[model samples]
Target: MAQAPSTRLAENAETRKTRLRLWLNILRTARTVENALREEMRVSYDQTLPRFEILAMLERSESGLRMSALSEQLLVSNGNVTGIVERLVQDGLVERLPVPGDKRATLVRLTHKGEAVFAEMADVHERWVNDLLRAVPPETAQPLIDALTTVRRQIQQD
Candidate 1:
C-alpha cells in the first residue's frame, strides 16, 4: 500500500535528524584524533603536524612539486607554505630549486636528511594511529570506509 503524505514526511524528518547527529559525532571523533596526534607529534618529535604533512607530501614525489602546486595540494595559502618551506630549507631537510623556463616558479623537494627523518616519523605515526584505532575491527572499518568514500564523492559532485 502507498504511504500517506504525513507518514512519508515524518520518516524523512527523522532521517534528517539522524544525519545531523551522525555528522556531529563524526566531527567530534575527528577532532579528538587530530588533537591526540598533534600532541604526540609535538612531544615525541618536536614537530608540528603541518611540517610533517609537508615532508610526507614531498616524500611521495620524485622530482618534487612546485611551490604553488604544493600549496594547492595542501589546500593552504602560498604564504602559509612559504614560511614552512623557508624553515625546512634552513634546517637542511628540504631544498628549493628553480623550475627551468619558469623564473617565477620554484620546486621543493625532500633532501636526503628529510627522506630519512620522514621514514622514521612515518613508522611511528602509523603505529600511533593503529594503536588509537585498535578497537575498530577491519570488518567494521571497511564498511565505514566505503560509506565515507561514497559520501566524499557525493560531496565533491555538489
Candidate 2:
C-alpha cells in the first residue's frame, strides 16, 4: 500500500530538521576546535591565528602575494591584514616589497626567520590537529574529507 501524502510530508520535514541539527553541530564543533587551536597558538607561541595563517599563505608562495590578495584570501578586511602584517614586519618575520611598476601596490612574503618559525609551528600544529581529531578512525578520514568537500562545493553554489 502507498503511503499517505501527509505521512510523506511529515517524514520529509523530519529529515530536514535532522539535517539542520547536523549542520549546527558541525558549526559548533568547528568553532570549538578553532578556539582550542587559537588558545594553543597564543599560549605556546604568543602568536595569533591570523599571523600564523598569513605566514602559512606566504610560505606556500615562492615569491609573495599582493596585499589585496592576502586580504581576499584570508577573507578579512585590508586594515586587519595591514595591522597583522605590520606586526609581522616588526618581528622581522615578514617583509613588504614595493610591487614593480605599481607604486600603489606591495607584495608580502615570509622572511628566512618566518620560514623557520613557520616550519616549527606547522609541525606542532599538525600534531595538535591529529591529537584533537584522534577519535576519528584512520579508515574514515578520506570519506569524511570527501563529504566536507562536497558540502563546501554545494554551499558555494548557494
| Top TM-score hit | 1
Clashes of each: 0, 0
Report lDDT per candidate: 0.94, 0.95
Q: Which residue pairs come into collision in candidate 1?
A: none
The regions of model 1 sitting more than 4 angstroms off are 1-4
Q: Looking at model 2, which ten-residue stretch has the lowest summed lDDT?
A: 1-10
Worst 10 residues of 1 by lDDT: 1-10
Please give the lDDT score for candidate 1: 0.94
Best candidate according to lDDT: 2
Candidate 2, backbone clash total: 0
Which residue ranges in model 2 land beyond 4 Å of their true spot? 1-4
Please give, for residues 44-131, the per-residue lDDT of candidate 2 as tens digits: 9999999999999999998999999999999999999999999999999999999999999999999999999999999999998998
Residue 59's C-alpha lDDT in candidate 1?
94
